[model samples]
Target: MRLSARLLLVCLPLFSLPGLAAPVADLYQVREPVASQQPEERDAALGRALETLIQRLTGKADAAQSPALAQLRKEPQQVVSKYGYEGDALLVEFDSISTERALRQADFALWGANRPAILAWWLNDGSEGSSLVGDGQSAAQVLRQAAQYRGLPLRLPLADLSEQLLATPENLLAGEPDALRSASERYAADAQLAVLARESDGQWQAEWRLWLGDEREQGKAQGANQAALADALLLAVSQRLAPRFVVTPGAATSLTLEIQGVDLKRYAELQRLLEPFAAQLSKVQGETLTFQVNASVEQLRAQLALAQLHEVTEQAPATESDAEAATDGEPGPRILPRTDVLRFRW
Candidate 1:
């Protein structure tokens, strides 16, 4: 547990992870509310919990029904490392390596653990009255649990007077993110989600919008109550965000990445982000580092975006006229651009 691993050079002999700032600490663990601990009920809850785990990993709502998982579906207990009951909840932990290997063998694209954190600002309207859901409020607990079930790292605003003023019904359901974005600056979240829900005749319905970088995803969900509505909405969000980061196993390109401004915190964050890429530190030069990794270009960039790393675009080669002009003088050694090597700066 030494914090000083020489700028994480030792990296715990394959990067032993400390509890990180982002990335859910337990991606493979699921806590599903159970009706009872009876054999039949416990068995059913474990199946549902496995389904939730698969949905969280593949970002596909129907992944549990895949033919490749038929064996696991039949024998879900085979992958369950441990299970226990806590009050009315059933906690199940699945074997991570087995789950990922099974999914990868089935040609499923898997999202890494270093997922983005969503800052949610929600407003609730009931027949009696309306109120903004704050981080310290009891109502926020359901949202937190639902986010955990969906494997999303959710953040709630303090809901102070200023935030309460900003959480009007119109603003929460607005298509634009300007006001919410301005209010969310202090949170440093990777995405902004504004939701408005209303309960009528004991049924809950919700409308939500999510802004992740330049991409926008919006959806509507309904449930018998508030907690169901929260789960329904977060399932949609997880599915929408998964495609942006899922790395298919087809390509195993041996790529090199050069990152500048390597420090303690940055190294820790980089280790998590590059985990799926199978990254290895190759060399270090002052504040910069070079790593050899195996990953696809498209998905790699998407993962690095979570760290706010800027890609260094290589300059265009000189045109024919400029090339002829340069020929007049002694040409220096040409360094060819490498498509496999990506460059980024913090």
Candidate 2:
């Protein structure tokens, strides 16, 4: 439906849950605006929707063209669970089981529903004036819609006077997360995205910087309007992030995670972060906590890194461990696990 909807972005003050990534609810649904209900236009929209879904699942924009998907392309409706029309939009829900099987058969890595939430600090400059897009701002709807299509969970700052001063075009263009790190801490997002867009001669050009964990990404895109720019930006972001967390079929193995500092609050947070891995509590020794997790080692590490948990030696438990325990003569060196193990410090 394209009746000029209200801003779908909501102001979400993050809970104190570190590494608790937001989950996308409708991962199998696709909604695209259509010009008309004509058969040809509907078919084209269906094709485009299929492509978007493939990219959302695989993080590869070109995944739909792969030979493995040739049959799906020929019969796009084969995996579709339902289809409907709402105003000027085409809503399609793909059969998740069938779609995931198809993706696995194609050897495409799958990005799970547990995705990182990105805090977006967007500024736009036009002939009228310059403004920062807040959660409730009109400019936010385009970004929100784009994020939905790309399966990205997005958060927008309040854009108060303080943020207006801090999220300047200069700082955004500098592409340093540290500049906004303090302001972003309250959002508790796993990733930070700063965007600076300017309109000239009826064309929009945007410069963006994304800070996710330790990695930094920078890119540029141009579009005829704000909606186009937003889609392009979110698509680019999805591509960049999907590879870090996507799970390959049959590539997962059991791992032992020994971490330090698991109080009640952290226990809940850690549990949520590791839920995707099927983490099981192995043992609790002093400040050290053990979790037996079934997941890809690399993906697990990457996921943990979002909470600022870094690889450390068993010399110290990760997170809330008493650093002075070693000097204070705690128990003898903790017995190390014989199987594969990863040690992290919070």
Candidate 3:
């Protein structure tokens, strides 16, 4: 049976509460343009592959036909393909219990025991090959490792300005909406990130213009261009939104969060030290604070252990999809279908 595929957009949480216990936000920097990959096709392929695997596992070709398996079977294509492009490699593939995996790999996963069931099938294939070529992390592991996505920056389509302005910086200073719009469209990306800076008499002004696509919204705010100010506004806007984000554990059943102690001074110190964790926090009363305090303690110990376990580095690890497995095996180039899982385009 053919598995239908669609683009799945998972907008992870923007701001985590201040004093978060563990580094909950997984940060990802896109080094490649993720526009051309086709997740729908990938999902469809994944669905078909799983269906075949299940049949191989239980000796049932119609295993996917079961009503309980309907969702996975229907959207298999949307479930597997993720932010892939030509010449890119898969560094990690985590199979978590949540649908968020679909958005991260730019692909999808069949929830419940389905993950293990699929894995079972993959193992049984005995083809001496791994069906999913990620770094061997489960779906849940991958999701937990991914950083939260900051909200999209504004995108503007500027009209072509008169050619006279292109000749000189002085004329360029006399800005035009069309020119600015073009600039926004050019640098503004699928993630809606923009860069606008202005200089006035030794002062550097960085401006971030947010475009609201809703029809009822109009007008914009222009604040003095200070990096701090720009950063604050961007943080405020991005952090204010609650992304439809959830973490799926690597195993079945709820994951236990064991909180150990309550220490405000320690919490405060940890907060300052862990500022680079790509999350925000707010003051919560009583036990919440205590819980986080202990969590941070555990986290610090873990980080120390991890650092001891590996080489020190100034950069984060690279993220990739399971497709990286196909790289050396196939000498020829391959083409994958493209699908827009989420629309942030202005």
Model 3 accuracy (lDDT, Cα): 0.28
lDDT of 1 by residue, 296-342 (tens): 88788878887888899877576666666578875544556878889
Residue 202 displacement in candidate 3 (angstroms): 5.8
Would you list the rank order by TM-score, best first? 1, 2, 3
Query: If both were scored by lDDT, which would come out higher, candidate 1 or candidate 2?
Result: 1
lDDT of 3 by residue, 20-115 (tens): 122222122222223234765444445544453333222233545777666666755433334333454222122322333332232221111101
- The best candidate by TM-score is 1
Task: Provide the lDDT at 329 for model 1.
Answer: 79
Cα deviation of 339, candidate 1, in Å: 1.9
Candidate order by lDDT, decreasing, is 1, 2, 3
After the best TM-score superposition of candidate 3, give how far the Cα of residue 321 lies from its true spot, in angstroms: 54
- Which candidate comes out best when scored by lDDT? 1
Q: In candidate 2, where is summed lDDT lowest over 10 consecutive residues?
A: 1-10
Q: lDDT of all the models against the reference? A: 0.85, 0.82, 0.28
- Cα shift from native, residue 195, model 3 (Å): 6.1
- Supply candidate 2's per-residue lDDT for 281: 78
Model 1 lDDT vs. the true structure? 0.85
